[model samples]
Target: MDNNIFGYDHNNTWVHQLTGTSKLLFFILVSIIAMISYDVRFITLVLILSLIILYQSQIKWSQVRLIVKLILIFACLNLITVYIFSPGHGAYLYGTQHIILHLGYFTLTKEQLFYELNLALKYLVTVPISLVFLITTNPSEFSSSLNHIGVSYRLSYAVSLALRYIPDVQRDYQEISMAQQARGYELSKKGKFMTRIKGVSQILIPLILSSLDKIQVISQAMELRRFGKNKKRTWYMARKFSRNDYLTIVLAILIVLLGVWFMKIDGGRFFNPFK
Candidate 1:
């Protein structure tokens, strides 16, 4: 089916074979550790590890290329804004001012540049893993895993529906765009930027109507099936955790512990090499 857009496909890869619960747990643990630590060494290590896992995932670069580009743009904007607003933030944080260059109200210091580098590394590390979690986990299986972790079945199923809807929405948009194009509408990059935006905006009205209709159909079907009538339900896609799953989670925990250890050793989250 539309696996790429929805972020799930059946594959024989080891990452795909891991139980959804274990993968979810690992993602959460690692994400928390990444967000909490500012130690450059620790962040770099996690970024490297995440890249390795991403390579092992065997996800097609084409599927995520646009997203990667967007994240890169955003990360660059973030660094620029942070530096623009507080040019000496890094110096202030590290309690050192080794200036690299000085402008009117902005002075680029080694510490500030290093701080920004770590911030960029954090984004590079976390974004790919977040994408991996989305691209790898099966919605139904993930829903079941959420329930297994004591989440409400209704909430879990809602999450599953949201994930399933992404591809549907994308497919609808493409179909509508093609139909419009066949009717002599120009929505591509050949037109002026604003013109293209206007053309694309025209698609949204029909898309919304179609989405509403689909929602009604799905709601009726669920009602006829008496979905959510019971407090609990069995899942056909539920899977038992395997040895690899256990090992994966254990490794994630160990990495988080290592980050914590680095924080302790550094006496803070910021690793000051200048010191």
Candidate 2:
């Protein structure tokens, strides 16, 4: 389990055994459903479901701590930005404003807070499923799955290459950061927040260069092999769908239907409690 980067780490769990296509489709459908609906009940259920799926995968916090922290920081910034731009938007959506606090220009309301909660949950709803897909699915298998689903092999292979390259780029970043720290630049908690941010920024230039070099090397290798010379290519890593994969896909479909039903009952995706 790589602590610093999020990548496919082979685990002996049932989740890992499921075909990449099912997981990929689930990720895409769940993300779309979660984003389209704003009802807190539906969002919370999906969020909890996603967490349960993640837990069943047997992933550890230590393996995902860095990415989780980065996501949380972004989530916080998003929430703050929403409040700053549309403080009253929530009240307007739910059609009521139960005042909670009066911070001059920003009069805190129960509706606003509830709206924010739903927004936060919506943002979080897809995270675990995404992690499950990214961590459990093999890039080669994923590409094959995409091709199996009618995507061009070339396009699917490009996606696979990007997925395969992500961890390498992250590894390069880690090495560069360590070297910078060895030379007395602090990227760790030992330094101030801004200083650490600056240290990270300084490493980006070389990281990009390293990534470009890798791209060139890979392109040359592919060209030498005459890759994409044919219209369609066969996949050696293709996986057959199993009972579990079928059931998992069914469950994902059921979840999407549930979200749609909730939207219908809520009379347009946003649940109105004030009514």
Candidate 3:
């Protein structure tokens, strides 16, 4: 199935070969660094590296089509909203106002443009790695890794189920959609946009009902098995760290350290070219 959800895509690439724990740690550390700094060179490097990792994972554009569109929409809206709300905030940050355009009350300046450039790069830096992490990490294995690292097995398993259920839910939606199509409702491209939208809503109610029923069944099964009775539990999906895992983790740490160094060198979060 061409998965329309963010779930593990089974493949035998180098990115997929690393243990879930390593990817988890690397994502966390790298996200921290990316979130903290506004250094263009550093952020660009991170963005490039993230894109390289995305390519290495061999993830198809089709599997990510919906999510990529959504993120782009959100990112663009956010950038526009930021500019609308804070037209002069960037010039304020850089302590200089080099006007480039006259947009009535909103005067465009190099500082504001640069700020937005950094912000846009921030999105690029984080989104690819985030997508790769979601698409490549095996949910059950990641849960086991979490518990192995001192997380409660109960919570970890919940996370696993949540991740696992996403694809299941998407699958269910597709099936329901197909059923609807058979009964004279088509969500195809030929239909009007509003008609397609209405058809979608028609499927949502059944999908939600199915999901709730599944959740109840799962909970009852876990209770019958006396899950979470013990404070500690062993993981069947537990993965051992390999040399690649160690190497990847070290690289993540190095990247974080490099971000810190860039912060110190830049003397602040904003790498002001208009200084």
Which candidate achieves the best TM-score against the true structure? 3
Residue by residue across 66-141, what tens digits does model 2's lDDT show?
8888888999999999999889998899888889998866889999898999888977887798888988999999
Q: For each candidate, give its TM-score against the true structure.
A: 0.94, 0.93, 0.96
Task: List lDDT for all candidates, in order.
Answer: 0.87, 0.89, 0.90
75-101: candidate 1 lDDT, tens digit per residue:
999999999899988999999989888
88 Cα displacement, candidate 1 (Å): 1.9
Candidate 1 lowest-lDDT run of ten: 1-10
TM-score of the candidate numbered 2? 0.93
State the lDDT at 267 in candidate 1. 92
Of the candidates numbered 1 and 2, which has the greater lDDT value? 2
Sorting all predicted structures by TM-score, with the top scorer first, yields 3, 1, 2
Off by over 4 Å in 3: 3-5
- How much is the lDDT of residue 265 in candidate 2? 94
Error of 2 at 122 (Å): 0.6
Tell me the deviation in Å of residue 110 in model 3.
1.4
